[model samples]
Target chain A: MSGAGEPEVRLLGSWASPFVLRVMVALRLKVVEYEMQQETLGNKSELLLRSNPVHKKIPVLLHNGKPISESLIIVQYIDEIWASTPAILPSDPYRRAVERFWGEYIGDKFSQVIRVLRGSVPGDKDKMAGEMFTALQYLEEAFVSCSQGKQYFGGDSISYLDIAAGSHLAWIKAVEKISGIKLLDEARFPNLFAWADRFCAHPAVVDVMPDPDKLVEFTVKHAAMCAPK
Target chain B: MSGAGEPEVRLLGSWASPFVLRVMVALRLKVVEYEMQQETLGNKSELLLRSNPVHKKIPVLLHNGKPISESLIIVQYIDEIWASTPAILPSDPYRRAVERFWGEYIGDKFSQVIRVLRGSVPGDKDKMAGEMFTALQYLEEAFVSCSQGKQYFGGDSISYLDIAAGSHLAWIKAVEKISGIKLLDEARFPNLFAWADRFCAHPAVVDVMPDPDKLVEFTVKHAAMCAPK
Candidate 1:
């Protein structure tokens, strides 16, 4: 019991990163008390480097000075370390695999949406937009199958899959605004839109997400900086 | 002990897939007997769809009725199920995290190499080759740091990281031959080169890998068929 009392949890993160937000949401959902150290990308703290030397990226979770990097891996680590809690993944093996499949699909396809936002040339932008539309169409189909009259990606409650997809909502909205294109057509994907709403409204998710207005401002400013002179 | 006498494991895979080869190597390493069903990409088998309905891709490892997908996840599942023998991952959390870091890094960077192989035009091929070379340089640096003075990626005895990276050797070699560009310079990255050789020679890896001559022949023939006219 005393051993449990002394275990320290620390998170190194930046506010703008959705990856960091995923870990934050998982910690909040698990009710794990942790210290947060906001890292500056320009002058990264030595602790962050020591924690995650290879990637040297933020969102490093330190459990008793043992660091785990990679946002998804950190989330899984949190779930494993704090096993006596509301499970973030399904108990059934097949269901857990299903959750993982959705998480990976989101990861693999979401980059195309970002690519479109990052594009400068009209032709390149159009090509990427078409790819984004195709990805969204696939997502619509997947969500229809996954939702199956459930409130969340993992069914009744928010799970890791929900966190994985929901974390990108801020970035997605940012890209939509920057590109002046609406990919998440509500009429076309009502269930997916509803799921996104429920996912955003979830207490754990809501608490950790970056301010939408600030995210939009950052995205627009960044886009302007990258725009052809 | 009698529980070990359960139904034989079955793998649904494509011969050319690096992902499938990872599972094949793992199964071989563990000395577990299994059946292999090669899946056709054009018309997937019903069992493949039934086993991994979400992703619907190889490789899916079916142990009795339970299906595990995602090559890395399947590797973990195999490690957990066969806990009585040689551990594929390090027991220490930090080391395990390091192993996973390399696994994810290889996965993230793999597409650059694939892109190089898939490029059509001379200019595009050259650009892709440069990208692949840069990615290989990073791998070389990583190998220098991680495998310094060690026989294997996990330091003696092929661990999951070795198996994960090893699966790509045939593809890498094939790409080199097909693209007429070699990224893994033996002079520049002796450790990585030696590691690759050792990985290929390992009995488990050696037994499961598609023959190198056949791999190069198939890849060259496939490239000709798929190349943009």
Candidate 2:
């Protein structure tokens, strides 16, 4: 259906957002060409606001002018619309459900851990680090079973879960560097540690992922600004 | 493939949980035969713990020994595996994405609003009531667009978004009764208000829905138990 000429695809995102990186990775993985618009936080563009009235956040995908918001939902929309080789989601429904479960897990559980590590949420750093380790340990077990002895969670190819969790790679590194927290310990979470490396190095992800050093600087500055007067 | 002589389906849930009610509605909708195991709070069953090791929450659907946690994920699994009439999600991917966006909105936004209303999270009741009304207003707009003048978000059928938001109907009512904070104001959110009535009365949902009066009593008792002496 998209053969009605190349679909006009546009992505609204910021430079450092991991969520935006997710949409970028998906587009690159699917080989879909799109125009990227950089958005500045606190002074959002009207288009971004209009596109996603509910969340009013970035990484809204405009497919031939119809906007799809939410990073994961937009990725799914890309996967569905493109419908080409190298599917983002698995073909089987059960497998798809499993992927979704982990994706939600990454968004909910791991995201909170990252927030704690970044000092975005006030918490005992030691306690949060332990919680982070426990969550990654769970994901390590999940990767072993879900990957089926493959390189990525998608099993030899990048898939939904990969993009979902993988998008947070730079942020993970940045948080670890800034907080002196050893989260992705190779010995403790060997599978997840390796997967993180592979995911960051992937063709679709390498160019798009935020630099860990720059992220550290940004996160530190942002945290300082947000601290009480 | 589930024709492997009636797959053993069991649902682990607590009676008062809206999340649990979602799975119940989905099963009833699909006409899927399932064993319902009631779990008591403070005394969770080992099966419940084993089935959902991560969140360790109720509403875990055990399908032929494979456990799927999370209410929405379980509903999708049921829809996929059953693959029968009255699909929970829309067939078109774009439409599915739209429904998913709203489903997630209900879970994230509406759920938070409800939490505030219940006094579960300490907050000014007036501010939370305003937020609850604002969220409902958004849903009202979402229904108008998504429903396309149809009776339900699924367009003539009670679909994913319906079950997701519908499960919380009793809780919404109970909060209204307990706090006297009106959320689903018919005058303001006519579409969603009417949709709520229709959703509650749906065959798949009616019997499984927790009684609003009972829920009010339970919520009050539970809140009292947790209150500071």
Candidate 3:
């Protein structure tokens, strides 16, 4: 743990969820030692439900015994608790707001991409593909403008924005295979593609990401089940 | 402002947006002195765009010239900056996390009702209504049960979660009128309906909610424009 007097941290999460991966990356980035418990969604442990009864979702981070749900909230809590090393967010308020804007944008916009890719019918595949492409286009524009040749989304060093966006990389790749629609085309989204490569290469992120091949397999199988006939 | 040495806080928002109303209610509950700027979406002011370039959507709160976007972010920022009487959030980390979970749930789940009510075709309307009903059922079962007969979402006193959920009352009513579907029936959702009434009665919320009749008129007109002939 980074803080000597602070309570020990524990994380409850599932291995395959991109949302769960986000918390893992933030903890690793902050160098906050935490006890990890892999949760099963089918039979969510009583403790997991008790800790986050409102959402009853995974990626719940418990500081001492006080649990914080939502991956972004957990990330902010981690930043607040561990203030020593490389700051994960910018100090300037405007810039911080900008980073947060991107975070919210991803949560609001790209989330739909995941939903569409997972649930799109064969007849509506083209429509879903278009939505995914539009989201990617927006992401590409944001990356090119905000990143400005930096290795990460928030700038030279990896910040929370990179962690936020990076968490989706494995899922995006998995969805590409499952849906058979490559929205993140290198020729079209060079900046986003390059950023994804750099994001996955980061030590903290690399250490936490689920196995890409297994993720692809799982997503493909799940998509087949959810796909509209 | 509640803070001893801080400058006044101002909110830029539209009267129709529930997201904006959340911030307004939070500010009122905190007793923060502020100004209001009603933004027109078609001709967004330079300040609104500059304050929130990425989304350019309101409920942007400016504190000492620094802007905070995202309704929940602005609420937390408001709570942190104005540490005066009648705390809008629980100080306990666990309770605070629970509050946040509900706040996020309202954003994620209830927001979908807008999309459902906006559906144009008969099949789309039925599908969306079914989904909206499912969402309402979940809230009635899970969220109302969790409230445990409290006056607010958190308990006796209002909290951030109450503001988040309460802001949707006008929109919910408007959508119900447009779609001829009432998910928030008084008998079926007694606790939720009563809570909405209490929420609107609260001085903080009462002062800022958009004119309900005007909101209904606007929504009906807008729906007509989008409805299939």
Candidate 4:
């Protein structure tokens, strides 16, 4: 707290957010000390509003008062600022882009996931599940590409891609159990299944995970809001 | 024709697509020479199919036989490889994140623009247009943050953010002409409206614009498909 001239690093985040956890894990991975101010979802704090006026969402990392939003963007920024720490993205430009391609794919899957979880219509639940499976297969292929002869997505160490997709593993498992849908079937996605297990077990990753009971409670409560009107 | 050592660069893209133009302008700005292999929308080629197996979509930049898909990702890759050329993203991580935030906002507006253009339903047309305005106002604010008494969103030189958002100007203008709604109104978005003109007139940007009449014709043809059923 009393470091001379060191920039005050603060995180405006929510315990309910995996995106927030990504930044927290990234910060912890680098051993960067930061203060956390938990944010209420519905009634956001004025500080967050001032920090990230655009999205008005959490996981905004304030570096000496300047705010950086978006989970992937924040994680990358963390890696860059803490250059002394192990690199999250590759040094090579081409490799970085390839990593970024898969990292960005997590965003690509959002709509399909929402449709899958909520169902386009309550009656259309089965139809949307098919679409979600097709989408999950593509993600499985992405994970497999870099998992060859390696433990993590980045091979030896955790990467921006791993943090990008791995943050969702907790939520996915919670959804799977609550919804009773075996989306990440062990046989269909052995690599991703194992990757999720390994990601959750990582000490830094474990530090950011939400309480198990609270997570299930959240998914149950939010299912109606997620469902199509 | 490339020299012996120069990597063989190729772009698999549809002339009708705006995303392809983003990569085109980026390459031109960097003075990187690349051959364009046009792709038909409905009928994709084997090269494109093999290159980008994930999204099977266009604007894939093939570098030395290795393919990089997603226009924004490709643009960053081009910036990285041609490092000496005028940088697209800033060298500073914080600045780069801020820029990425705006670049990413373009994605947020896509659905709003579609809803505005296609109309969710006949009665819902006006409501969608209002949402588009609220969205554009945010983009205008983003531009103002970086413009800072300069010509472009990137200040003097075009940037990743500039290419990301500027690529859509033609579509916005075309939509304005066809719909007569004037989404980017001069008084409301003084900076962004002028930016559209300046961006279009840039030599590199000019080289990538589609045939005006062809663009309008394609829009007319696609209206029925884009409309909510």
lDDT of 4 at A28: 86
The better-scoring model by TM-score among 1 and 4 is 4
In the range B1-229, model 3's lDDT, one tens digit per residue, is: 3466555677889888899998988888887778888897578989999987767889889887778899987887677667786778776555665667667876776777575674432346666667666656656664565567677766777888788778888877777777778768888777777787888898988877777677778866766776689
lDDT of 2 by residue, A135-201 (tens): 7887888799889999988898999999998998898898999888888889988889889988988
Worst 10 residues of 3 chain B by lDDT: B115-124
Candidate RMSDs in Å, in order, are 5.3, 2.8, 6.1, 3.8
Per-residue error at B19 for model 1, in Å? 1.8
Report the C-alpha displacement of residue B217, candidate 4, in angstroms.
2.4
What TM-score is obtained by chain A of candidate 1?
Answer: 0.87
Candidate 3 residues A1-229, lDDT tens each?
A: 3366555887889888888888898888888778888887468988899987756888888887777888877777677667777788777655666677778777656666766675533336678678667777877887776777777777788887787778888877777776778877999988889888888888888877877678777766766765689
| Alpha-carbon lDDT of model 1 | 0.77
RMSD of 4: 3.8
Q: Which regions in candidate 2 have their CA more than 4 angstroms from the true location?
A: A1-7, A221-229, B1-7, B224-229
Q: Residue-wise lDDT of candidate 1 within A134-209, one digit each (tens)?
A: 7667666766666577787666777888888788887777777777878777987777788888888888878778
- Predicted structure 3, TM vs. truth: 0.71
Residues B1-229 of candidate 4 have per-residue lDDT tens digits of 3568655899988776778988999899999888889998668999899998878999899888788998888988999899885899888899899888878778557445753564333535556568778877887888888878788878898998888888877766666666667787999988888888898899998867775566667777776666679
Interface RMSD of 1: 2.4
Q: Which candidate number maximizes DockQ?
A: 4
Q: Which ten residues in a row have the lowest lDDT in candidate 1 chain A?
A: A114-123
The positional error of residue B50 in candidate 4, measured at the CA in angstroms, is 2.6
Q: How close is candidate 1 to the true structure, as a TM-score?
A: 0.77
Q: Which 10 residues in a row give candidate 4 chain B its minimum summed lDDT?
A: B114-123
